[model samples]
Target: MPRLNAVLETALYVADMPRARAFFEEALGLSPFTADHRFTAYTVGPSVLLLFLEGETTETVILPGQMGTIPPHDGSGRVHMAFAIDAADLAGWEQTLDAHGTSIEGRTHWPKGGESLYFRDPDGHLLELATPGVWPNY
Candidate 1:
């Protein structure tokens, strides 16, 4: 096997694109790197978080300059995405979420000494902010 470096992108399909975009922008303070009527992409640290309107990506998308084609993709139900944060930053993050009116839906104290704060986006996708030690590598 060659190797795997990192996850480049993650997508979440939403019933309302504007609402979803706003939630991420306001709650997480993420600004979109690129966007169009079909979708909006926010640079989440090194990776990208794409918010695609439900049913909009049912057909393959052809990129300009013959770069490549993105195959049709869609998702439903509650899905989860976790972001890594420092232990010292956890409290600030919770405060930020509260200021944005985003509630902390749940939390978990991992056996590895990590802590996670769980919540939902406008689309109801479960989002997590996890501190290091949550994983062996981290």
Candidate 2:
């Protein structure tokens, strides 16, 4: 018997689609993978990050249905998305984000190794970029 390896994709609701796209592209360096009237997608290494415009339309509230092999979401509060990068790339990433005027909330360092920086999107959702070897064994 054969089994399928699980993969993950993330979707986020943005109030301003254009701004969100610019931030993800310029600040995070994620290349545009696809786009449409309702949504835009960026290629994040092996995964894809999707952003959908959500607001009080004249009609009804739009809730995203499961669209990927693994849909990432949190039912309550503002959801968070985390990007993992090689430890060596951490400094460069930080500089790039700074140049793009990304506000840094703070960073956490692990005693064993690695660290992560927290920030927010234009919509006030939490986002993080973490270096590899960060989380110690559970």
Error of 2 at 79 (Å): 1.6
Q: Tell me how many clashing residue pairs each candidate has.
A: 0, 0
TM-score result, candidate 2? 0.75
State the lDDT of candidate 2 residue by residue for 1-138, as single tens digits. 898553467878877778888888877777777887657888777778878777422244345685434233323247898888888888887898788888789899877677888988778889988886566531
Evaluate residue 111 in candidate 1 and report its C-alpha lDDT on the 0 to 100 scale. Answer: 95
Q: Write the per-residue lDDT of candidate 1 for residues 1-138, one digit (tens) a residue.
A: 999998999988899888888888888989998999979998888899898888899998998996999899888888999998999999999999999999999999999999999999987889999998788887
lDDT of 2: 0.75
C-alpha TM-score for every candidate: 0.94, 0.75
Model 2 misplaced regions, further than 4 Å = 1-4, 55-77, 136-138
Query: Model 1, which residues run further than 4 Å from truth?
Result: none
Top candidate, metric lDDT: 1
How good is model 1 by TM-score?
A: 0.94
